[model samples]
Target: MHESLFSYINQNAASPLTSDEEALIMASFQPKKYRKKQYFLQEGDVCKYVGFIVKGAMRQYSVDDKGAEHIVNLFLENWWVSDRESAVMLTPSRYNIDTWEDTELLVATVADMVDLIGKIPLFGQMTRLMDQRSFIASQRRLNSTISNTADKRYEEFADNHPKFIQRFPQHIIASYLGITKDTLSRVRKQAMKK
Candidate 1:
């Protein structure tokens, strides 16, 4: 499980971690598991931990006043999960995070993350890279939602994230793409013909 994190760090960091740095990380992060449908975070609860997925899937979403769920993000193995604002600002999360499958995670408290960032240069660099990628992806997704037609959005999503198409249900993918499930089905059928 730790090896998965080590590999992610090695792939993303400017430099590989040293033995002592790995030890520091091991001490800071603890392994946790969630069964399918279990909640990692609930709406209005403060998020206390950041989790790196070792295996399985999760989704971050919000429920509207009408009780409809709007998925903000879907995560798979090697992805990091947290309500950043809730964790950083010590505020309640507006979104709920839950496991889509039986999941394994390595989780760390905010303080532990801060300590690791201060102590390990490579770890800090990796986190900054992750943050930048996250921001860029979010901006792109928002732009697509605003500017692209449903068909175009579905095409782009399929081209870029084929794994999501395979792993997630059509309804979940539709929610993420800001389209109705019927629209997604039509788009997919049209795409298949093309």
Candidate 2:
């Protein structure tokens, strides 16, 4: 169950963890499971824990005044899911996070994570790398949404995240691309022809 987390840490950390470090890190997280459609977080609630997904998928989204959900992010195996702002600031989150399928997570509270960061040098390094990558990904997505054409966006997304295409629904993919479902259908059909 902790294999993926250890693998991620080993891949990202400046150095591999010692067995003692691994044991300490493992002790910090608690395993939990969520049924499909269960809430990890709700809008207006404070996000208390940052969860590392062990298996399955989750999504973070917000409902507009019109009551339509706009997905902001998706999570899968080896991904970390949380409203960082809410967790750090102890404020209500604007987004709702929920399981898309039966999901397993290893979760740690902000305090526990802070303690781990202080105690584990490699863990800190791994987390810093994760933060940097997350920021870069967010910037790229923002730029793509602003500058790319709908078709270009879908093509790029499909090429970059083929797993998402297989795992998520078309409507969710369309939302993530900031395009309408019909536009996504047209783009997909056009791609099929090409």
Candidate 3:
């Protein structure tokens, strides 16, 4: 259960927190369950909490004026999900987050994060590192989308997340890849044949 979170924290965060600091952060965190199709954060709403998935899948997406959904990110077991724009700016979100499956999450409110940084400065360093890592990953994604071919995108995605290929449905994979379902099917077939 929380062993995953502990491992994640230990991996990303160095310099252990003081007992008081750890307790404060833990106090503000509460576990919540979301069912399939549930909306965690809708576009235009302020995101109040950052969540770590205990189990299940969630997608952060944007919808165009034409009512098309473009997946910006996908999170599954042991992943964190948040509307980064709103979280960083403390403003309404442009992304909508929803459960792609029944999900269990450990949620830490924004207030707690502020307090954590104030009490445990090392946590701040940990957070900065995580943010930088996320930025680099996003930049790589943009590069892949713009500079790489569609087949390359599929190959890269598969290489990065073999578990996702087996866990997520094909349609969702297509959404994450910025491709049509049919194209994803073909690309996957070609990749497997090779």
lDDT (0 to 1) per candidate: 0.95, 0.92, 0.84
**Candidate 3 lDDT, tens digit per residue, 1-194?**
55566566657777665666656656766789999989999999999888989899898998999988888998888788888779879899999999988999989887787777677776777778878989999999999988987799999999998888877789888888889999998998999899
Error of 1 at 89 (Å): 1.7
Global local distance difference test of model 1: 0.95
Clashes by residue pair, model 2? none
Ranking by lDDT: 1, 2, 3
| lDDT by residue for model 2 (1-194), tens | 88788888999977888899889878989899999999999999999898999999999999999998899998889999999999999999999999999999999888889999999998899889989999999999999999999999999998988888888999999988999999999999999999
Model 1: per-residue Cα lDDT over 1-194, one tens digit each: 89999999999987889999999999999999999999999999999999999999999999999998999999999999999999988999999999999999999998999999999999999999999999999999999999999999999999988988888899999999999999999999999999
Model 1 lowest lDDT segment of ten: 159-168
- TM-score of every model? 0.98, 0.97, 0.92
Candidate 2 scores a C-alpha RMSD against the true structure in Å of: 0.9
Residue-pair clashes per candidate = 0, 0, 0
Per-residue error (Å), model 2, residue 61: 0.2
Against the true structure, whose TM-score is highest?
1
Q: Lowest summed lDDT over 10 consecutive residues: which window, candidate 3?
A: 1-10
Write the number of the candidate with greater lDDT, choosing between 2 and 3: 2
Model 3 clash count equals: 0
